[model samples]
Structures are given as structure tokens and as C-alpha cells.
Target chain A: MLKNLLMALFVVMQGAAFAEIAVIVHPSQGAAISQDDISRVFMGRSGDIAGETFIPVNLADSHPAKAHFDQAVLGRSSSQIKAYWSRLVFTGKGTPPKEVGSDSEVLTLVAKNPNIIGYVPLSMVDDSVRVVATF
Target chain B: MQCTKFVWVPALFVASTVSAVDFQYGGFLTVGAGTIIDKKESAYDYEGFNCPCFISDFNTAGLYERGDIGWKQDTRLGLQGTVRFQPGLSLTAQGVARGSDSSVNLEWLYLSYDLTNEITLQVGRKRIPLYYYSDFQDVGLAYIWARPTQALYGWEASNYNGASVRYATFSGHWEIQASAFAGNETVRKSGFARIYDEVNQDIRWRNILGADLEVTRDWFTARVVYLQSDNSITDKPDSADFSRPADKQRVFGLALNADFNDWLILSEFNTNTRKSRDEELSIPAPAMSVGVGRRIGAWTPFINYARFWEKSKDADYENERFIDLSATLRYDITSSSAFKFQINRFSDRSEFQFVGATTLLSANYNLVF
Candidate 1:
């Protein structure tokens, strides 16, 4: 039968080349994060983690889990995070992190914002968010 | 003039169509070209430009003369816009459009705010933060150099009218940032005094004050800066004879960077001075730049070196040096575009041989959208 549809399309392309990714938040948010506070809140340089005021979100630069969350949590590449946010968005100094489009739209904007934060693909996490780190 | 500085870009799009702001908008472009594939013939003559020229932008005196190529010495086109209005205030504006003076100026028009989540508070007319890529030097897809190093990035007043504050945090894994500023400027027809008087000159700096600091870890970074000012000039056919008054100036800077995920490094150093309220003239002026690169995927190639010298101990002041060397490659071409190719040389060890020794051969394409 066409070799079982080419072994079911090579196991769904090897499970999307070894999926993984996670990092969500908002199951009534409980602060605790590190990997350098999610790489300084996805490189807009901190917007809190233990001082509360979170709100990072992104995954739409042609999402492939945004190139595996920009090479596993912003170690860069996606053209160096688009040249580091084009030098902080042409120098008004910073503003980058607010993009959505998939993984159920970042699990419905991190299950309806409790100070949002996002990332997905650990088999599209469920239970209304709260994974808080994985790469 | 320049449509009254863009009449606030159609009044910020009619105040973001009557309230509930947001706006956004972006842009950037380069499309460059160059020429002067080598030269040496010197006999001094800057005010009439020609004879191996190559100023490639000294605060927009962007020359390159020496026949052919030359798409306005590094084309341009910016745009930017912000708006926001809530969640911590905002309102930016930018406008560019150059091809060397086919006009359309009004760079940045600040207003940021966000006084917490680690400080920030800007005011108006920015750029003059003086190096470390002077706050996104026209965003050539955020640099890999197709330009930068016009011997220490020349300036005579690249905007200022400011009030700044910025602060960013993350201690213990480093990544700090700081700034403080106060400004004034006047520039009127001073493309750095038309490379030395042709006519319309006029420059000032006045009360300006400054500060800077930067830090980073994980592939190192460092920076420092300081400044002070009160300079002056005005000629407009007043036929120079020598007398520049309000001089007090001071500056100091430093930078160091590294990347290491495919090797890269960049450096800078500066010194300025200027005294002379007739204390038998002081002058000073030192500069430096360094670069290196190596990323081979979407290409990257780089190399650079720069200098500027000019120390004077008054023996009748005459120094003014120069040096530059470049070699770029870049490529990316997506993720917001890029495509470079350079090859510069410049030398001109100065003793009034102003824009002499040259070499150049550029190309660019940069973009942002």
C-alpha cells in the first residue's frame, strides 16, 4: 500500500525533527524561571520574572517553533534574532516580543494571559498552560 | 523646510485616527554603490571637492567623487514610526530619505517613557549618543558594515536636542545598560563645515552633557562614555581668518565586544578635547576602531581598522591624521535582508592633504521592512 504511505511520512518527519520546545506560563502563574530568566525575557532585556511583570510571546518568523525557539532559548540565529531586533528597533532602544501564530496560538495566548509568556511544541502542551521551561 | 520636520508625520497619522493608539510601522533600506577604485594624486583642494575624493559621509557630506558609480554614496531611506500611547507611553518617528541630500531629513523624534521595569525616559531629536554604532547607524540591517568607520564615524552634530535616561538591568549574569544625557545642537548647513568651508557653516554644541555604560556577559561586551560640551563656529562667508570662540569640549569613550558563536569582535576608543578660549589652543582628537568577523553560513567575512589622530601641543597646530581599511562581505539576504561587499582604503596622513589617498569600491543592499 505504497509501503504504508512511506512509513507514515517518515514518522511525521521524525516527529518534526525531534520536537521539544515548551516554555509556557499562566496556570494562575507561579514565578520561577531561569535560563537567564528566559534569556532576559527573550532579549528585550528583562521585563521581570521575580518582580512580577512578565509578558513575552513570540513564534512567528515563519514558525518552526521559531527555529526551535531561536536555537534553544535565544542562543541566537534567525539571522541573529534579526540582527538583535535591528538594534533595539532602530534605537528607540527596545521592543520585540509579541508575535503569535500557532501551537494553538501559543496555547491561546498562554491560556488567556496571567501576565503571559509563551512557546510551545512539547507535543503542544495542554492543561491550560504552565510548563515554564524546556528547550 | 523639510516640510517643517515632516509636520509630525501627518500629525502621527491624525493622532492614530483619533485615539486608542497603537500605530507601529517600520522601514529601512540602503541600496548603495560606490567608486574611486584607487587614487593618490594630491595637491590639496577640499572646498571644491574632487581629486581623489572620498568622504563617504562625514555627517552627510557623503562625497565619493572620482568618476562613475556613486549611487549617492551609500543610498538611504528610513521611516520608522511607533505611537503606542498606553501601557507605558510611546511615540517615535523617524524619516530619512537620502541619496546624499535629495533631502527628507527629520531623524528620530522620540518620546518614550516606561519609567520602570528598569527605567527609560527619552525626549526628542536623538542620535548623538556617539558610537557603539551611534544608536543604530541608519540600520543597515543592523550592521556588518558597508559603512561605519569613516575614520571614527565623523560628526559635527548629528542631531541632539535631547534629554535621555535609559537604564536596563540584569545583574549577576551581567547585561546592564545605562545612559544619561542632556543636549543642544545647532548644525545649520554644516556638513561638518562643508569639509572645510565652501560657505554655509554654523555649528554649535552648547551645554550638552553625557554619560554611558554598558556591560554584558556570555560572549563579552563593555562600554563607557562621557562627554561635555560648548563649542561654536559660524562662517557663512564671514570669510574665516581664525576665531572659533565658545570652545570647551571634552569626550572619552571606549567599547569592546565579542560574540564567539562563530567568532566576531569589534572595538572602539575615542578621545576628543578642544580647550582653546585662547589658552594657546588645545585640540586633542584621538580615535580608533577595530573589527573582525567569521561566520560562514549566511556568510559574514569582515575586517576593519580605523584611526583618526590629531594631537596638538601647539607648535602652531597642524596635525589631523587618518587611516582606514575595510573589507566586508555579509550576505544573509533574508531575515530582513542584507548583502554587502566592500573594500576601502583611505589613508591621507594629513598635513592638509584633506581628502587625498583613496581606494573604495562598495556595494550594499540592506533592508528591513
Candidate 2:
């Protein structure tokens, strides 16, 4: 029984292995994105990146992938983010990243806007939205 | 007042007209009704006492409908706007009714500038930032509770008109913010006081000052805050009462929040006091409380317990302790709106004291732009 439980735990741990949030852009767009720049983009703390401007888009709050990105990337929850932006919003300091719907939808939108950067499941990666940086 | 109302129109219309400006303005009006059985004590006719703090005075001024049997839901319509002008500069403004009772009052207004790569500054009228929820005390989007602990931020000087600066990731996964402010030091005035001021004098107040700090990491966020306020008086229209001195009050607070995958943990505490040195005149009362909140799927159910104990030094303190148990439920109606409802039961114990235990139920829809 102990060995079986250990095996089950191992499976669960494997399922929860580290993952990355792929900051994606239109495949045709010519923008070099570094990993650190991607984190700054989604967090909305970035002022300027490269010569071209950056527009960060977020998955809808209710989307499951959003939770994954928050845990695997931003390392927080929707409530924490809301509390965070509340401090910013109430004081006129920071604006949260704009939210879009679905992984595929984010891919489509980012694929169309040169300035746009969004995150999606690795499975959805295609020429439509170029993976700028993974994680 | 008309000018005050107009300033919002052009601003609202400007964003509304913008074809696509990450701006979406929304809010809701709710009607809540419920009955509560006092688990503690009963009411008293203290309104007729010699001290004479009128029923309307300690009544519900700038407060919700007792959140009990009446329209306890502080139904309100609010507007919030976000404008992005440059990479490091943005502006946001929010305003809401103090309650179903107060006339329109400005809630928040500020302009922010991100200086350097890690520091940001804001100037204008804003929440005092004295608690985790101070910045969004009345805004309903940040949590699962109908309201954060009143003990955590119930002081009269919890809001302010001034400036604040924030340093985020100055070193690592931590951020710190501080603010200083001054605003009208208005007190809990009775009807008689209002009458005296309207008929005999001007309604002016002294400047108040305060500040707060917050830091966060991968899985945790913490905060501490303090505020001091000068006292004001409602002098008699006809009397030899040379009585109008500054009343000094200080409030200190702390809160911690942690999240792990599907589980969450949160706790907050506060202590507030009012008095003058020499014991000239003093509320001399200090109060504090703690609470916990969690989330589950699309529906996040939460429970919180709080206690309010007023010192006996001042007659008003009453040596009374207030205990409250509350539950809240939330469901997302759309990507941009949510429906929330809450139920709270209150208990108060102190011989001959006012403010007793009551039960209240309320609900509202929250939307944003």
C-alpha cells in the first residue's frame, strides 16, 4: 500500500511539474523578446521594450489557464492580483493588463496585433502567434 | 455641487467616446432584506439619556442600512475609468455613493506617474491606504467578504486627500508604499450640531495626517498602516463654551495573505485609540479584530469572525465588546460582472450601552469599466 501511494504521489507530482507561460506575438512581427521582458510585459510594469511599443493581454479572470499562468509565471492568485491592482487603482498608480478570452482567442488576437503579447497553452502554439519566450 | 457633478460628465464622455480605450464603466443597485435573532443582548432607550447623543447622531450617517432587516444593501452606482497615455504613465478614477443614504460623494481621484524603473507616485484625493483593503474599502471586486473588518479600518480618518509613493521590486519580490494626507476632520456630529453650524457658523475642519506600507512575495503579501487626526468640535450657537480643541487619534494595522494552488489563508489585525495627553478629553478607547477568507471554484464561500472591544476610560467606550459572524457567496455572472450576497449577525454586551447585536442580509452586483 505504501509503495502504491508513493507511486500515486509521484504521478501527481509529475503532473504538477514546472511549466512556462509562452509570451506570444504575430509570427510575421519582427520583435525580439527576452524572458525577463516577457515577465515585465504581462505584469504591466514594463515602460518600453525594444523600439516598438508593447501591449500585454491577459487571459480572462475565470479562465483556468489564467490560474496556470498565475501559478507557473506571475506566482499569485486572482484575488491577490485584484488586491494588488486595488492598491494601484485606488491610488492611480498601475493599470492591470487587459483581459482577453480563451487560449485560442488570445492566440488569434496576438497573431493579428504586432504590438500585442499574450500567453496560451503550449499546444496552441502555431505560426499564427509566434512564441516570443517560453516561461 | 453642480460643478462637482459636471467635472465627472466630460471625463466620462471623453472615455465613452473613445472608440477603444480599455475602459468599461459598470455598477449595480441592490435591495437586500433579512431578519436576525440576537445571540447577545437587546436594545435600550439610551437616546433619551442625559448625555443626549441623539438617535440620529449615532444613527446611520454615511453608513449602510444597518445591513439587517431594512435595505441593508448599500446599493450604489459607480464609474471607474482607465487611461493609458504613455508606457510608464496611466490614470484611473473611481467614485461611489457612501451608502444608499449619503448623497453623491467623491470616493477616489488620483493621477499616477511611474518614475524611474521601480518607483511610482500618486497625488490627489484617495483612500488612506491604512489596511490591506483600505485602498478598495468600499469597492466590491477584490474579495469574497461583504466588508473587511470595521475594526481593521473603522477610524474616522481612514480616507484622505493627499499623495502616496510606491517602490516595487526595488530589491526582489517585495513592494513598499507610503502616503501622507490632510482632509476635513469631521466628527460624528448629531442633528443638533448640524443645526448649530448651519444657523450660526461655518463648517470648516483642520488638516489630518497619516501613512501605510505593503510588501509581497511569491506566495505571500503583508501590510501595515497608521493615521493621525486632529479633533473638531460642534460649538453651541449660543453659549460660553470655548471648546474646540484638536482631538488626536492613532490607528495601527497589520494583515497577511497566502495562496497555494486551490487553497488560501488570510488574517488581519488592528488597534486604534483617541485622546489628548493630560487626559483633558479622551475617547481613550482602543479596538482590534482578525478574519480569514478562502476560495472554491467559480463559487467562493467565505466566513469571518471579528470582535470590537472599547475601553472604559471614556464613557463612550462603554466597556462593551462587539462580536460578529459573517458569511459571503460570490458567482461570476459574466466576464465583467459578479453577483455577491452576504449575511452578518452582530452581538453587543455592555450594561446600558447603545449599538446592540443584530442580524443583516445584503447582496449586490459589481461591475467595472
Candidate 3:
């Protein structure tokens, strides 16, 4: 009885957790990209995507969406990711995606920049940016 | 270099009253004490306590405490960038001084240039790719009570000066990354003894040149490190070589790490060999360490066994072994800081000339801006 109860709770709780993040871009973006391409864009570690000049934008460190984006999209801890990026930044070898604040801010920026890709909460979804992937 | 200025710099000023990038920092501090349980006697004169905490000082020849224990501090303060920088280019650096060192040496300075989709060209004086912990061994960031046995197999200088080129390939469930480095190495050792007015005693091995490589794939990472130096080490024994040509020495190491979710296992074996007449006259030294750790939520507990052996034509030459352990727990109170605590034990088997066996225990509080 206890095992079944625990399993039910686990399943119910899993439903509440998000599985993927929506990678949004300005409505102006017409590029038909791939899944691997999307991962590269968000990791900020990628140099190019499908030959198109695209830039990945990150949410501010403290934003709630940042957590969803990290686990659902980036698949890393905030600390591990930062350690990963500092290795690039301090050396002048690479720059990560641009960072913006708030779901509304990211949506507005994506709605405006054709080459920009960002993430936001599902509720904030709108016509300004397209959902590139569930994650 | 064109859009070089901080892109996130303006975001801080435009946002709220307190900017994340403005740099606010604080850290926790913990101290502890412990006792030496066992020892073998040698005229070398040294300490052999295996408590890994930073608090205990001065190596006692060979003394054991019945239930000996004391304060432990794994405390650290740091600065973390909150605004977040662009992916292609960024700037970062850190300074830490939690132990006996007077100040935090410049830990990392480099330019990470993404050459292609998979290759990253990082050039500058960053941590030498010696072993896994070689990268984040700082007390402020390292989550382990003590570094893994494979990384600190021996008492080796932790950092190197040089540029590293790293490449990585990622697929669905698998990932691979490799790094190679070319850099200058520096190390120091010093001691003094006095005889009658006409006689004086001094001994030391001050510095060297080194390089190392690391490669990793899903669940496994391997590393090799080499350090070479001439007798030109910064300090020389006063009674010895005033003009004697410096001798050459090499430290070679190899290790592997395996991670299966919350449980991670690691092993390392290394040997330090010196090639010079002076070395032969002194001793052939080699060291090894093996350790394992597990992560539970924000807390992790680990244990390691290490030994450093030195051989000279002289028999009763001193060889020492150390046992270390600690439980480290951290709860990320926020994005820039975390609360941490550590318990440790250090011990030595034989007291070699001047090198005594002692024990230490500590707790650490760390803060990052």
C-alpha cells in the first residue's frame, strides 16, 4: 500500500515539473531549424547554427524561468554552467548568450530581434516569439 | 574584440537599485582540531596527523591523541557574476585565501574563443589540466570535504601558467571533451638549521615547469600530468650548491573518474621521479591517492587514502601515508552563495627527517558575489 501511494505521488509530482522549455525568437525569424541546432544555440557554447547567424539569449540569473530553462533546456546546474562559461569568458575566448530580465523582457526582445532566441514561462507565450522546442 | 565591452554591464545599471554585477560578497568560516593516532620514528623529524581540516598547525614528530579532535573551517568567500555574459565572449576571475596562504593567487585568466561548433580555444594562464579537481579545487567552490584522491595524489603545486585548447562533441546521450595545455609551472620548498657558528643547514625545492592533459566522455574522464624542472628552483641550500648546476626532475600522473548519477567513484596513480645526481643523493619520491564520494541533495560525504614514499640509498629513509575524510553539505541559499560545512582527518605513518605527523579538522563557510 505504501509503495503504491509513493509511486502515485511521484507520478503526480512529475506531471507538475516541466520537461522542455520553449526557445522563442522574434516572429520575424523564418528559419526552419533542427533539435541539435537548438541545443547549440542555448548552450551559448556554440559558434554557429545551420549556417545562420543566430545568438542565444539567457535569462537573468535569479529569474524563475532561468531554472526551468536550465533543467529543461540546458541540462545543467546554474553553478556548473557558470563554471563552464567562466572558462570561456575570462579568457576572451567566447561570449555566452545575452541575458535579459523577466518573461516580458525576453519576449519583447525576441519579438524584436530576428536573430535572437530566448526562453520564457509557458503562460507568457505570445505571437512575438515562436516555440523552437518544448525544452 | 569589437563588441568587447560588457554587454551585461548596462543591464545592471538599467534594472534595479541593487545590481547583481556590482559585486557583493560574503563567505562562511569553520575551524577544527584533531589528534595523531599512529607513527613510526625516523630522525627526519616530522608530523603525521591525517586530519584534512585546515586548523591544526605545526607538525608534531609522532604523537597520537586518544580521542583527539578539534574546530574545522572549510569557509570561503567569493564573487559570482549574476547579470550573465554573452555566450561567445566573457570575462571572469577569482581570488581565494582560506588556508595558510597570505592571499588568493590569480586562479584563472583566459580568453575562450569558440573556433568552431565543437572546438574552444582558451588561451591564458588558467588552472593547468592536471586532474579533475585541478579545475575547481578552490575551497570556495569545490563541493568535496577534501579533493578527490586522484587529483591530489601527492603534495603537488595546484596551478600552472599557460594556455589550453579544449574541444567537445555532444550527441543525444553521450558527450566528449578533451583539453591539452602548454604552461610554466612554479613550486617552492624551504627550511633552515644551524650548527656551531661555522656550520649552517638548509634544504629546499622551490620551483619547476609543468603541463598536463585531460579527456572525458559520458561518465568517464582521464588525465595525465608532467612537471619538469632544473636545479634552478627559487631557493637553494645555503651550505650546498652556490653555483652547482640545477638538476632535472619529472612528475608523471594518470587517473580516471567514473560517475553514475548520485554516486561517483574515482582512482588515481602518480609517480614523481627526479633525474639528477642531487636527486639520487637525496631520494626517489613517488606518491599515490585513491578516493570516493557520494552526493545527497546539497550534501556530499567522501573518503580518501594517500601515500607519499621517498627513497634514498639511505635505509631508514622516511615514507609516509595519510588517511583523509570529510562530510560536506551545501544548500544553495541563493544563486551567488551557498552554506557549507566540512569534517576531516589527516595522519602520517612515519616521521621522516623534519617532516612530522599531525591531525587537523575544519568547517568552511563560503560566499560568492
- The candidate scoring highest on TM-score is 2
In candidate 1, which residue pairs clash?
B57-B62
Residues B1-369 of candidate 3 have per-residue lDDT tens digits of: 112134443552353444333321222222223333334333332233222212222111112233344322122233323122343344445554444344455666555566766776766556644544556544344344432332142333445556666667755545555666656544433111121011332223334455555665556777777766544333223434432455556668787777654677777776665545653445556666666777565555666565555554555444434444444455555444455444445444434333334343334444332
lDDT of 3: 0.50
Higher-TM-score candidate of 1 and 2? 2
TM-score of each: 0.36, 0.71, 0.68
Q: Which whole-number lDDT from 0 to 100 does residue B67 have in model 2?
A: 18
Q: Which stretches of candidate 3 lie over 4 Å from their true place?
A: A1-20, A28-40, A76-97, B1-6, B9-94, B97-99, B107-126, B146-156, B159-211, B231-243, B279-286, B310-316, B325-332, B351-359
Tens digits of per-residue lDDT, candidate 1, B1-369, equal: 011122232332253346545667777889899898755555655778775788888887888877667897788988888887765788888888888887788888989898886798999988878778887888887779898886777878877888899888877788889888998988778787788777867788978899999898989998988888888887557544224568888889898989896889898999888887966589888999988999887889989888998888788778889888888999996777889999888888877657888888898898887
Task: Provide per-model DockQ scores.
Answer: 0.26, 0.19, 0.20
Interface RMSD of each: 11.8, 8.8, 6.4
- Score candidate 2 by lDDT: 0.56
Per-residue lDDT, model 2, residue B19, is 43
lDDT of each: 0.80, 0.56, 0.50
RMSD of candidates 1 onward, in order: 18.4, 8.1, 7.5
By DockQ, is 2 or 3 better? 3
lDDT ranking of the models: 1, 2, 3
Fraction of true interface contacts that also occur in model 2: 0.25
Scoring the B chain of model 1 against the true B chain gives a TM-score of: 0.33
